[model samples]
Target: MCSHYEPVITKKQLATHFKVADLEDGLKPELWPGYIGPFIRKHEYADVGDDAVPFRELMVGSFGMIPHWSKDTKIARMTYNARSETVAEKPSFRDAWRLNRHCIIPAQAIFEPDWSTGKAVPTRIVRTDGKPMGIAGIWTGWKNPANGEILRSFSMLTVNADDHEFMRNFHKPQDEKRMVVILQEEDYDGWLSATWQDSRQYLKQFPAELMQTQTEAWTTDLP
Candidate 1:
């Protein structure tokens, strides 16, 4: 499961890479469970006749899922990563999953702890081609009692990575290896428009060869 991740993707990257134009305010550069971040969801302009309307809209939301039934946003801390196997049954994630509230999280890279050397070391993971990743997730809206403000939040879907050649190397040797669901560029549109029955098909792990990891020595960002 992810503790936290840096979604270093900028507004320009969101436009060109994800083809997103309808956007909300920007979020922090890095995101913890309760921090704000950007996510892409399929939206219809309420018109099927407009061929030029953008199908994808970028919006700001908390990294962790804040279920509608929850009393507070505190639930976000523990609901950031939804397990793939039980996502449909989990109380916090089931609503979004069943309603097809799928979304795409644009991330330039993700940080995972490498515990291979008897000590934890922060490591960076990125696509081999140096492109931003479109991570799969589900979103929901919660009404705050204190201010009556409705805020959107989401959770990243994760799958068992124990057998994955690259991802399996992270985390503790004794712990279960898991990774975020990374969707292919070609499947971006299809994924956001997926129904509950077809959503599970997109939770597979990304190919290991197409991804590479770097220890805590990286300097320059991807161009």
Candidate 2:
């Protein structure tokens, strides 16, 4: 599960990359579950039909899956990471997937645990080429009937990484290996435009050779 990540780029830079209009400033440099982060989705317009306008827009959304029917925000923590194999069928993600509510999560690095040293050790992973990565995700919009407030949240999709030499090195030994689906530059627009059936084809592991990892040991002594 990709619970933590760093967004090294500014919203202005992201807006430029995605060719979108101006963005909301003050985006966080790092984010965790329940924290707001940048996400890209099709612009919503009342009069626009499916093909009327194809402008992609950026928004600041919280990380987690708050199903529209959810009564409260309690379920978000558990829905932060949705398994790719079952995403299309899972109750929490099914509706969004069926509606093509796909999104892209930009991140410079992700934190995970390394167990190669016989203990759970913290490590940060990044692209070897130093380019930012766009993780495949699905988002949901939940409304609070009491005050008519809406909460837009998302979940990162993960695929089996047991066979991935580098990715398999993280997480607990007993837990099944998994990794977030990072899309290539050429597939960005296609991923968002793809239907549920076509989207399934992008849920694959990124090449381990193009990734790099740095580990830091935990110390018992306090400063």
Candidate 3:
């Protein structure tokens, strides 16, 4: 599961890369400065509607998921990734999978592990061509009953790891599958379309050669 990710790029860089010329017009620009984190925030994306109508709502979202019907907040802490195989049936993700799907999780790289030696070893998986990788995602809004706080969050969708050499060792023994569904630039329209069936049909694996992998430094310091 993709429980860990890193968005090391600056907000300015991300805006340019995503072809979003009007950051202030669409989202709160002031929020961008403090959004850098181990987990990317939802304030970073441009909400282009199904018709590709650009809206001013913040598009970036937390990696974990918060079901629309959830009664508590702790569930989100454990729902960072959703398996594509069972997403349509899972209670926590089914509604969002069928309705409120989203896009644009701007990321340079993600961390995964190989536990072959009985000791987990970390590896940084990045785009082989040095381009940013965008993972297909789903989002939802949850209102906290205690304080009436509304939290918008999302989860990355994972599929079977095929020939992606870089991701071959990321999964645990119980689940050999390891990969995030990556939509190509041309397929972006199909993915974000309002037609749920069309969107699901367009979801496909990115080329394995598109990724580059390397061992990451082990650190105990908090970010």
Against the reference, the lDDT scores of all candidates come to 0.87, 0.81, 0.62
Q: Which scores higher on TM-score, 2 or 3? A: 2
In terms of lDDT, model 1 sits at 0.87
Who is ahead in lDDT, 1 or 2?
1
Off by over 4 Å in 3: 21-57, 219-223
lDDT of 2 at 87: 88
Q: Assess the local accuracy of residue 205 in candidate 1 as a C-alpha lDDT between 0 and 100.
A: 95
Residue-by-residue lDDT tens digits, candidate 2, 1-223:
7887876457555765565555677876677777777787767661266665656767777788989888887787788899988987889899999999999888888878788788966678999987888899999898988899888999999999999989998999998999999999788888888888788888899999989985544322211
TM-score of 2: 0.88
Worst 10 residues of 3 by lDDT: 28-37
**How would you encode candidate 1's per-residue C-alpha lDDT over 1-223 as one tens digit per residue?**
7756777456688888998865555566667789888899987471476778778878889889999999998899999999989999999999999998999998888888899998877788889998899999999999999999999998999999999999999999999999999999999999999898988789999999999985556453432
lDDT of 3 by residue, 186-219 (tens): 6554555545565666556778778778566754
